[model samples]
Target: MNGVLKALALPVVLFTGWWVLSADSESFYAPPLSQILTAFGDTWTLEQLKADVLPSLLRLFAGFLLAALIGVAAGVAIGSSRRLRAVTEPVLEFFRAIPPPVLVPVIMLFAGIGDAMKVIVIVFGCVWPILLNTVEGVRAVDSVVLETARSYGVTGTARITRVILPSASPQIATGLRQALSIAIILMVISEMFAASNGLGFTIVQFQRSFAIPEMWSGIILLGLLGFGLSLLFRLAERRALRWYEGLRAAQRSS
Candidate 1:
């Protein structure tokens, strides 16, 4: 309860300030907070949610998941082999330097303005952080630990599951957290161009049509959605890294 309240304090204060500041605004572009909230409630119906919000969320999840899988897998391979890592480092850096949005047009040409294109854009944007972090994590694993695993006859899949993955999990979690925000940004950007059935598209539509309050509402929804996802990601990270946390606690106590 305390944590929830603390988390909400800033948003509550900001909302209160916004309400007071805009209470008497007469500008068409800057409607009162009350009007914006009213429009938010009125326009974002169940059907509208199904048509716009759900698809965007689905694409976000799909792209993020794909990025996570590929990043971790490739990171592990490259991290485990010095030759492979050396060979790929320049290529990885080159690709990572390119912005994800810039690739949308090229991806659209190949993927043809579909969900595939959006997901590809998101994955391209998100994968670099995760892959790089995971590589660093793997490389940072203690040599003694690797030797111990090897001595115990742990090889191949068993070694990865029992030794490598656990050791690098903390850094992997960090990468995932970073990638999630990137994924959300890419999701919206991908939807902005050549899209008709997403929250981003809806917001753009409202803006072009001069539905200011509705556009504001969509922006609010996006902020809330990002906040909610961050909260959920943190929860999952805590749960997944419980063992790592316990170890750190023990070390601190010592």
Candidate 2:
């Protein structure tokens, strides 16, 4: 109830304030809250929304999923193998330091400004956070536990499955959370700057059409999309790391 109230309080205040401030603004910069809501009602109608949002979501899922798989694999390999880590660590760091937006030109040139290009960009943009997080999670595993497992009959695949992965699950989850946020932002940005579909594209189209309310609706929908996705991912993270969380709490109490 307290959490519910906290969430509701901000939106109530913000919407009321926006309603007052933008009710009669002549500029597109301040569209009335009522009009914005109306635009949301129209644009977010099931048929209209499905047409616009589905494509973006499909793209987002594809790119994000691809990145997570490849990133986790690469991360595990790098984290586990000293030789691989030694060779690729600098290169990974160098590439990660560079912004994905900067590579749009090259990506568009090579891949063409389509789904393939956008998905690839999203993959490149999102993979680093996940990969780095996986490496950190793996490295942060307790040395004592590792040694004990080795002392036991646990070697090779058994040890990795029984020990390393469980130890690193928490941080990998955290990394996924971060990567998801980045992916959402990149999805909109990629669509906005490049494509002819998605919420970003719809917003651009409406803005050009001088449909202020509709444009604002696109922005609102985008916000809601990101928020909904974040909340869902957070719940998943909590569920996934419940065991680790319990262990931490026990440790604190002890």
| Winner by TM-score | 1
Give the TM-scores of the predictions, in the order they appear. Answer: 0.97, 0.91
User: Which residue pairs clash in candidate 1?
Assistant: none
Q: Which pairs, if any, clash in model 2? A: none
lDDT of each: 0.95, 0.84
Residue lDDT tens for model 2, 137-226:
888889999999999989888887888878888878877888888888888778876687887788889989988888888888888888
Q: What is the lDDT of candidate 1?
A: 0.95
- The lDDT leader among the candidates is 1
Model 2 worst lDDT run, 10 consecutive residues: 1-10
